[model samples]
Target chain A: MLVTCLPDVAKDVGANRILKTRAGHFHHPFGDPSRPEASERRWRLEATKKALEVLTEPVTEPTVFEY
Target chain B: MPTNKKIRVVHYVNQFFAGVGGEEKGDHPLTFREGPVGPGLLLQRLLGAEGEVAGTLFCGDNAYAADPGAEAAALDHIERLAPDLLVAGPAFNAGRYGLACARLCLAVKAGGKTAAVTGMYPENPGVSACRRQVHIVPTGDTAGGMGEALPKIVRLGLKLARGEELGPAQEEGYLPRGVRYNAFAEVPAAQRAVDMVLKKVRGEPFTSEFTFLGFDRVAPPAPLKGLKGKKIAVVTEAGMVPPGNPDRIPGSRASTHHWNKYSFGGRTELPKGSFICIHGGFNTVFVNEDPDRMLALDALKQLEREGVFEKLHEEFLSTCGNGGPVHVMKQVGQAMAKEARAAGVEGVVLPAT
Candidate 1:
């Protein structure tokens, strides 16, 4: 499984389980420099949880789980 | 080359095509005949006066599989026969037969004496095994396609024997070998670009000069039963490494050896200034400010503390994905998987940049 800002790229490459992060940009897929340190950490933790959640779901093809 | 010269051809076939018994005769040993046999007769007819099937070699699929020296033996016979061309089976979709045909053709080509060719279904396992190495004309899924397949095989085989330059896959009626050749185009590049753009704007069909090959689809492994007691690892193409970049992994187009594993033992987070991002594809400032942003090491450690999984693997694997070639990246992925599996890692979180 993988987390990427470009879910279409993941799908194109046939990644079976993907988490599409609501990232600020390619530079910071998991971090929001605009946000305060604590809030950014919280957001990162939530993203990680979503990524882990993607692993437990059954998938017949490349399926993206939005976070 | 003299037009009157007769091209000597050696035809290869499996037991079924050789009139040997089916299934049971699959264990039949290597055998040779003086003249065209079965499909070779059609091949010779197609060759007409330009070529002759000097010999036909037959082997059982099971025999080929059972003997490691099967290909060597065939090569020895082919060498002694000294045919200008070796035409292996239009094997269609028969897996074992297709593989034997493909492998033998590849060996024949590598011998640098006989030009070799084969035919099979586009989706045959043999196509993948040797398409890039040998001329494999695509055929129908079964022997029902033999009529159409043989003409193409003969055409390609004859051209190869005469040392003629082959056209593109589409024009030559063979599988794409994933090779590019330089050619003089009738149109200039700038005009062609404009023409393509105009066609797109007009919504007319226009073929692109380049074709992107389709990626191989891998079936998803079974989902983990649960994450509670699982041992997970963090991996990334975000190129996070120690501040000094000890391994000297390049900023772009990193090779297989550029990938490395760094231990996060006893560390709850990747401290700022201690690690940095080296990927050249994107801005690394944010990740450099806090390396945990790229690897999620801090969040993963928090999850570890919460028993989300039994433990976070001690080492995290990383490589610079920027401009890395697909072949090199594949090797890097395999190497990382090997290391992670050896460390008893059950799951991996790969954050891509």
Candidate 2:
């Protein structure tokens, strides 16, 4: 499983499970400097949790779970 | 002008096919014969009056595998015979024999003086190793398929020897070498694409002009029971590294060695100016301002304290994902997996750029 802003790339490359983070950009998939430090940390925590959640789901094909 | 001269051919076979001994004679040295031997007889008959099996070259499977000079010796014999084509074995599933045939054919093809062709099972290791460098006709897994395989090999060999423009793999009946040749299509690409899209929408069967080679699908491992006490590791291709770029991981096209492990044992967050992103594919300013954006080190540490997981792995694995070749990246991934497993890491979070 991987976290990426470019979910299409991950899906095209055949990643079985992927977490698509809306809050992140290509440069920083987990961080958004625009948000306050606490808010950014909270978003990152949620994103990481979503990535962890993705791993527990059974996937027959490349599937993107949005965060 | 088309010359009337018969297409002179040199045939290659292992000891077993050459009537030398079987596995025992696998160590037999390279030997040359004046005319067709064993399967070469069939190859010659298939060629009829258009080609001649001028000479035969045979070597032990082990001999070829053990002898680094085997290819040079074969080339010398081929040069002396001056054959227009070199037809190696329909080696089938014989690993060593298949490898030898593919390698010798690759050498002959590289010489440019003679065209070369061989046959092997599609799954033969040799096929993957040298398919792009040589022409390999697909055969069955064993010699039982020779009757069906030889005719195709002979046909392809003759065309290659005559310097003919061959068609695509499906049409030519050879393995796809992954090299694209430019050819005029009946319709423009834009029209073809539209037709394909319409066909797809209409649920009609249509063959796509271009086929994408897909990566092998790996079955996902069963997920960890829970993160409560599991040791999770953070891995990234974000190119985050300590100041000064200690390992000199390239900004792109990073090979296996470029991947490195770094210790973030006690750090709550990656402080500014302490770590930097060297990835060439994206602007690094945002990540450089706060490295945690790329690695999530701070969040992971906080989670660790909150009992989200037992403890964060002391070290995080990293490499620049920007433009890394697929093959090298595969090796890097394997190496990182091995490392994580050895360290008893239960789960990994790999954030990619």
> Taking the tens digit of each residue's C-alpha lDDT, what string does model 2 give over B1-353?
15466899999999899998889999999999999999999999999998999999999999999998877898899989999999999999999999999889888888889999999998787886678788899999999999999999999998989988899987999998877888898999999999999999999999877755345567778777877778888888888888899999999999889989988857888888768888998789888988888888888887888887887898999998889867678789889999999999988888898
Candidate 2 — which residues are off by over 4 angstroms? A1-67, B1-3, B19-34, B58-67, B93-96, B217-269, B273-275, B278-285, B296-350
TM-score for all models, in order of appearance: 0.86, 0.69
Question: What is every candidate's C-alpha DockQ against the true complex, given to 2 decimals?
Answer: 0.83, 0.60
lDDT of 1 by residue, B220-296 (tens): 98898889999999888878887789999999999989989988757888888867898888878788888877788
Write candidate 1's Cα lDDT for A1-67 as tens digits.
8888888988987889998888545776777778899999999999998888888889999999988
For every candidate, what is the interface RMSD in angstroms?
Answer: 0.9, 1.3
DockQ of 1: 0.83
Among these predictions, the greatest DockQ belongs to 1
TM-score of chain A of 2: 0.95
